[model samples]
Target: MRKRERENPCGVCGHYHKYEEGEVCETCGHRMLATSEKASVHFSAFPSEILPQFLYLGSYDNASRSELLKTQGISRVLNTVPACQNLYKNSFTYHCLQDDKSLSFDDANQFLENCERDKARVLVHCMSGKSRSPAIVIAYLMKSKGWRLERSHQWVKERRPSIDLAEGTLVH
Candidate 1:
């Protein structure tokens, strides 16, 4: 007589059952599942040091953003466009939905005011971490840090080497 085999937990369904590759879970009948990749978002300094802070989330959709926000203590989102409906589920009290069309220093300063008043850390994102996000972040640094525009641009670039704001686009 053969002994019954113990089962592994289904990655998608969380049910413990004996399953094989391409096998459906008995409870949910999900044929496929995946283990999430655990990745850390890299930043230049400790959380408290960066003023009116900026975080780069690389490339994540709404669900990922919501999950990360819960863990990271991010209080607001400076989104280039509004997230998908119910993306935040009313979790956050503040949002600044800006366009990617040539952001200015005044715009960034306005965003800083909201963050300062609410005591919230801010995140700015575009599709990639290269151009648009860096533009806004540089502007914020100029207003908050009193750094020369060129120096501010160099600062974030040294920490996040991938930043590549286009020529003549940074707010003077």
Candidate 2:
């Protein structure tokens, strides 16, 4: 319980209290701790900028927020998690791929390439933004920029700092 408290301190009151699932903060009567725990653990303090002025990579939670997407000038979303809801379907051009390891990258790469050609900013996201999405971005770098898999992966890692590409997903 102490470990849980340490990991999930209340954002509002700054209290280190263990909260039961759905429990409100006792000290300040805030629900910060409860809500914080439900957010995507894959999120980083800073998401990766895969391509300057064109592509961003982030988690499902980040992709669902229309205001954040608008603020970043993201005109399209390439969601790698098929089951995840498209919260801003009408507002942004969307492309969804099922989160499967065997999924092909040809279409996704084409979509991203189109975005680049049109000068549109696109956000690529999966459930966690750690695996599927980054892999897609890496493939794009390889195809469009003519980079090898290792160099593309390294470049993404340097920018995002928390990307974890799944095993066997690296394409040359």
lDDT of 1 by residue, 89-160 (tens): 487544444443555557657876677676776656543455666677777777777888889888877766
Q: Clash number for model 2?
A: 0
Off by over 4 Å in 1: 1-64, 82-86, 98-100, 170-172
- Give all TM-scores, in the order shown: 0.57, 0.72
Off by over 4 Å in 2: 1-46, 98-101, 168-172
Cα lDDT for residue 20, candidate 2: 51
Q: Name the top TM-score candidate.
A: 2
TM-score of 1: 0.57
lDDT of 2: 0.75
The CA-based lDDT of model 1 is what?
Answer: 0.53
Candidate 2, residues 2-31, lDDT tens digits: the string is: 777888775423556644554654543334
